[model samples]
Target: MVLPPLRRLLRTAAWLLLFAALGALGLLLVRAFEARGKPDLMPWHRIVLAQELSADTLDARSTWADVLAREQQVFDDLHAQLAAAAVPGEFRYERGSRIGARAGERDGNRSFESMPAEPRGGVLLLHGLTDSPYSMHALATIYERAGFAVIAPRLPGHGTVPAALLDVRWQDWSAVVRIAMRELRARVGADAPIHIVGYSTGGALALDYALDALDDARLPAPQQVVLVSPMIGLRPFASLSRWLPLYGRFDYFEKSNWIDILPEFNPYKYNSFPANGALQSYLLTARLRGRIATRAAGGNLARLPPLLAFQSVLDSTVSSADVVHALFDRLPANGSELVLVDVNRASLLAPMLRSAAAGQIDVLRGTKPRAYRLDIIGNLRADTLDVGEQRYDPGSRVPVERPLRLAFPSDVYSLSHVALPFPCDDPLYGTTPRADEDYGIRLGTLVLRGERGALQVSAEQLQRLTCNPFFTYLEERVDAVLR
Candidate 1:
């Protein structure tokens, strides 16, 4: 009887061991399957959607030049498709409107009068880093119609050549603003309440001016300030450089890779400067914030002006929250207001918070202690921002679905980063009416439309539209407040 019982126990132990081995094998298989299913190694063509073909056209063609000329031809076709889908009459150019000026032109002063005057206060439009004043032409036209004199000045090393940007420092760009500010003051008088509007890095510079030099005896503080998608901090990708020593040593190490990454959106790839240029921008922003903090600590809040900032939560390019937090921390108590504009409120991602459990979506969290009233606006397009992760399938041999979201909040405002210098209805592309007259209007309305169907324009919008672009939402809010 003892021998039989022992034999059964031995068989049970053997069976248990076999089950454990099978379980381990299954786990290995699952991990291997997941690895094979990874999105890595997928063809670049298959990674991006058909729509990205146009946005990536310039980069794809230029970068793949080493591969074959056929690649360039393919991207060229994609570019044509993008142009066709773009808003009608949006990209046309006006007659006799020169884009870039040759150096040492004697007729430079003669053409000053070419820009039309408006009824509102004068506007000083500044472009972002690696960009020119040409980006502000379209928005500038809108300001002109709204009755404001617009001056879209090209920053140092920009609009001339890309190589010039290599040697250009942050101060050099700031100097250009100083000159433009002086000119605007001369044109509109010291107390005419000049409004300063900046895009991207330009917006950061504008904020710096407000913090550092606005109250200087040499130039009057701007009557109002507007920042669109300001670059206040290094993007998430920059975080990696902190860990890699090689990334810190070679400033230009990532330049080549970054240039090739997004060609169509960043046409200035050929003109990329040393990586130090980016470092300089980073340093300048840091210094600006430090200076503001120092001043606030010393109780010197009188120098800062009432400021308004507009940032798109879906922007893949800049940290919208960083800009707001930096400004919010430095601003005098109740001196500034923050506006968080949701450009993706209408897409599949419209109710973004609901999808958070899926690990594909997130909200902009304000780092500062203060709570900002968030105003979500649905964009004219599908309203979804392509975070890129959900659509990127590395294992798939075929192309992924294209991400369809506006590039920036201003893009919804009928202004491209490069076209803010000209009028909204400028004849550059043609005098034809755009099919979507309500493009920005819808966005503007959504911004004011609040819970319980109440429409109250936030304080930030009031400051932005004071001397520049006029939003009907702002007008209605002001009227209601007055009543």
Candidate 2:
């Protein structure tokens, strides 16, 4: 029934679409060839090898001292392996050049370090994926100053080469956490209260462990739980991340990964992330949610401790909405709280905010009594840059506002998922460190003024804010909880 001219136009458009799909697939195939042949970048460098790192075994759990010793031994192996495999002058794998230790000392960040003294209580700090004890160093210092003996373990598959994460599963991370908790309890005794602080992927582990403890009396229970940008849930695409490995099955696409591999420039965090890491994190979160439902059905949720969660409104990593619905909303009225850091409304970037971030504070407390408190740290007014706390008390619909001393940095639009743990003056990530104990690289003060693509790392990396302007408030809130 269609006219000849209209039918001819439709057929031509279909042909164009088919050609475009073929062109995209052809480009991917060409990319695989390019990646596999690059000398500075290789599959082995990115691939996970099975030599059984300390993070892969339960035998490392003798004592804190023994666990640290084993971790160092594993690092030694990684160093040797990297040295042997690295191409000359390649900064990614080179141990003592631009990317790693400068003073010939083993990377202090790769090993476990504690700020232990006469302690009032015990606090265990768990870092995120591809991060080490270094991520928690600033927070550990805060806990140390507050008379809390802090134990920040270098999670297995971290604090070493990027390839270390390839072979590691979620169980390995949970195992190390159990060992760390046992050591903390042994040091501080059973009667004294113990608190657990987790960031990103570590947050999932903390919630999972706490849920297990509720069911099992043998596992140690945290008196309180604090999460920073917790990974309670991820994007739906993460569930299918396991299929990513199938791409490597073909010879032409052997080097192809879920994400394009990059150089490792950052000392504390691995600049190169693996597909397996994402898959494990997704599986762990799935298990965590399933367990939460199981516990809720039995009316055993009352055993959960108070949870203080700090989430960014415009997070690209974890779901900010899930922080409210899946985790905090399910709590049984045990004085839990959710602190959301709103995007900078006063900045030029304010209009660029996604709809989710613009209405981030409206997570459903209207005309209803919620079990927990909701505190939003954001602008005092839409017209002003001044920041304050909008506190919604438990069971109250109306929020009480309190102005604070802090204000948003004019240039920074919003806090990132990783920025929550670091302060403005942190040695590596800070713009200015409160004290100068160097890790050889002071990335926080970097302000490069040059042509585009001049730096070795990406512009996207440089643009993301590394330090938190409101860190003093974070410290005060945490200190109050400790007291």
Using TM-score, give the best candidate's number. Answer: 2
Off by over 4 Å in 2: 1-56, 59-62, 86-92, 101-108, 111-117, 249-252, 363-367, 433-435, 438-440, 448-458
- What is candidate 1's lDDT per residue for 286-305, written digit by digit as tens? 78768777777887866566
- TM value for model 2: 0.86
Candidate 2 per-residue C-alpha lDDT over 1-483 given as tens digits, one digit per residue, 9 for 90 to 100:
999999999999999999997886676566656657533445334544444334445744356676677776776676676667766544546534565455665464664445456667788888998887778877787778877767887777887767677667888888778888888887888787888999999999888888877867877889999999999999887875675555566755655543446666577887776678889999999998887777777777998999998888877788887888777777888989888898888988899978877777565333567799988899998778899998888888788999999999888888988899999887678877655466556777777778896765777777778888998888888887888
Kindly state the number of residue pairs that clash in model 2. Answer: 2
Clashing pairs in 2: 425-432, 425-433
- Per-candidate TM equals 0.51, 0.86
Model 2, C-alpha of 225: deviation from truth (Å): 0.9
Choose the strongest candidate by lDDT: 2
| Model 1 worst lDDT run, 10 consecutive residues | 260-269
Q: After superposing candidate 1, which stretches have Cα over 4 Å from the reference?
A: 1-120, 236-274, 333-335, 343-346, 349-374, 378-483
